[model samples]
Target: MDLFPPDKILVDRVKNGDREAFTTLMERYQQKVFQTSMGFLHNQADAEDLTQEVFIKSYKSMKSFRGESSFGTWIYRITVNKAINQLRRNKLRAFAGLDAMKGEDSAADTNADAPLLRKEQKEQIKDALTKLNNAQKKVFVLFYYQELNLKEVAEVLELSPKATESLLFRARKNLQKELD
Candidate 1:
């Protein structure tokens, strides 16, 4: 039988002395983690750094993984929280340079100005996103950027569907106000 085990089993092993289990976990989710970070930070370098940081932080706190949620959901929460922290630590990073970032990780976006958006609009959107408190930003990123459904977002955030729905509503309202 394959002794490699699954994510939950890896978590169990990690809680024990099997450090390789964590490596397995990292290998499984590194890309997803990096992409999520990219969505939040919009910079490949920052996203890569944050992905490593998330795994390291998870290693330190592996004991807390109680299997209440899927390992992906658990790690996503960690990723979101760490990305928020990165945003807080460097609020000076401007989204005005989003064109540069877009080139670095071009994936064929359908935005009106995907190749080169108006700097002012990018700045306005970034400013609006930043103005959202942590809660709103989390919901906005997960739903809009990550394209997660309401139930999945609620699962990751550990909130009821109704609460998550309320968050999305408020986030839309707040973002519309900012863009207007």
Candidate 2:
């Protein structure tokens, strides 16, 4: 007897009104979803919120899943779309000066005593990522931050493998230019 069923089985169970099956799926994918969300939003609180939102949306739309792609790929597509939309909303808030009212420091608040060089590198990378076009940024984040392979990134982005590779190449080149 298997301790854990496959994602396809769990997905079917969720579609058939099995709430526990959905929870099992959530436990399996939540970390990856959170990490992917953080890769785009660059804020822990926002990423956590986005993670919850992604699962809620997925749960509501479970019946629409066609299984054309793997469950992981489908969930990742949702995470990416939600994260992009959140980024757009954040930009609008910043432009309106509402973000300043939140009184959140923009600096890396993860570690106070971290080495200066490491901190600067992280800032530089984050800045460089902002400069990328949306396609390049998506490919870069999915491939590097989410640790998805080229094929998986292609599947999630609904791009051909060659196209995904091209975007990743461009992203790396742009980042190099910005960092240098």
**Candidate 2 lDDT over residue span 1-180, tens digit each:** 456999999999999999999999999999999999988978788889999999999999999999989999999999999988988898899899998854245554666677989878877887899889889989999998899999999999999999999999999999999999
42: Cα error in model 1, Å: 1.9
lDDT by residue (tens digit), candidate 1, 1-180: 557688888888889979988888899989888888876776667789999999989999888889888988999999998998888666544355535554434333324454455655675676788788888788888888678899999999989999999999999999899999
Residue-level lDDT for 21 in candidate 2 = 94
Pairs that collide in candidate 2 are none
Candidate 1 off by > 4 Å: 92-117
How many angstroms is residue 179 displaced in model 1 relative to the true structure, after the best TM-score fit? 2.7
What local lDDT does model 2 show for residue 91?
81
CA lDDT, every model vs. true structure: 0.82, 0.90
TM-scores vs. true structure, each candidate: 0.75, 0.93
How many residue pairs in model 2 have overlapping backbones?
0
| Alpha carbon lDDT at 119, candidate 2 | 77
Task: Score residue 167 of candidate 2 by CA lDDT.
Answer: 99
* Model 1: lDDT of residue 101: 57
